[model samples]
Target: MRTRITTIAATVMLTAAAIAHAGNVGISAGDYYSPTLATTLTAQGNSVHAVGWYNDNVLSTYDVYIQDGSSFADAAALDRFVYHGGTLIQLPWSFTNIAYTADTTVFSRRRRGTLEQLNPGIDVIAPDDWLLAGVTLPEAGTQTIGREIGNRFADGATPVLEWEDGTALLGYRRYGAGLVVGFDVHLVTADASPLSADWSNRIIGNAISPVPELSTWAMLATGATMLLLRRRRPD
Candidate 1:
């Protein structure tokens, strides 16, 4: 009887650990200038969430759009800052003027923009709703910008954006659950020099490393094992 209990507890602990470590997702972009961009993301489970941002002196004067899988026409508009699973966020001129200054330790001169729900039937979260911090360019010759997004529902999940010498911009997006995340960065800038640097490196450095679900399962297993060992010991 004691041996049986010990084995059962070990198994249970391992399973729990795997589950806890299994759900992690992340994405990032480095130095780019273009009308649009895209990346592939991986999610462990059936359900996952995401967020994004852009850095430029151009206020909210442009439109941002997202799509899942293939087909941009079917892209969902992410105008609001709400979590809606696979829905995309789109920005229009109405969502302009949402700018702020980037600080080392704090966010200054922050501005809030409204995110509208484009497809009511689909569940999607808007950038405005998830935007934790951002920075704006001062209309000077050039300005480096930064932006960040995070998974409000998950633990230890956040993304960061950094602009280098007003010529380049880097961004990272992270989420919980070993989920693969894909995204694109659209730069509506006149200059193309910013997008030269290899973005993959920046992303790898900024984005959080994915944690395997199996790890969580292992923890659970360990816990169970501990209980089992305790029970198996001669009383």
Candidate 2:
């Protein structure tokens, strides 16, 4: 009976994953390879690629860029990309305060905390947010995250999920016409626990799609920029 129920649950989860946003996604893969993270997004019908290197020219191709525990040396390029309407997901070791990089240096240091093992382990702080769609506290409550990245959320950062102790588990902030998200959950190894994998993948799926209003505005802004560049072209 237990196995039957688990199978049903897995089917439901996979169905949800399948319906998620289908767009171009790039995951960091220079120094490290994050198979779980890559596979989860790919399952959502996205064209997932490993971004072994980056620059403004290369960054413009993808709709969303995910830094998965690899060193992203081009902060300025990332900033420019986000400003011009590209989504950014900072997972685990790629911690950074997108809107206010100077205000929170500690976040860049990347501190680690002990395992989270308790009832309601993953709290949905912003239940109404899209990031928690199809996710319930009961399903995620008992899952253990072996090591979590400690974060001091930047000003203007909104918390979508939290740890039992009130640390931000997942948060995001809009920058220019784009969005920047930070995750305490380890996407690289979230599959270590079935519940954790489900929870993290749901949040990431929502993020890549983003809210329609913001995404629309981003598209408009990018279009306007292109038009302006074309107008300035030498005849």
- TM per candidate comes to 0.25, 0.68
Off by over 4 Å in 2: 1-22, 30-33, 96-109, 113-120, 138-141, 147-149, 187-196, 211-235
Q: Considering only N, C-alpha and C atoms within 3 Å, which residue pairs clash in candidate 2?
A: none
Q: Which stretches of candidate 1 lie over 4 Å from their true place?
A: 1-18, 21-38, 42-222, 230-235
Residue 73 lDDT (model 1): 23
Worst 10 residues of 2 by lDDT: 97-106
What would the per-residue lDDT of candidate 2 be over residues 78-119, giving only the tens digit for each residue?
777788888887776555323225421213335654444543
Residue 150 deviation, candidate 2, in Å? 3.5
lDDT for each residue of candidate 1 in 162-215, tens digit (9 for 90 to 100): 222221122222212111122222212335332122333233212222222455
Winner by lDDT = 2
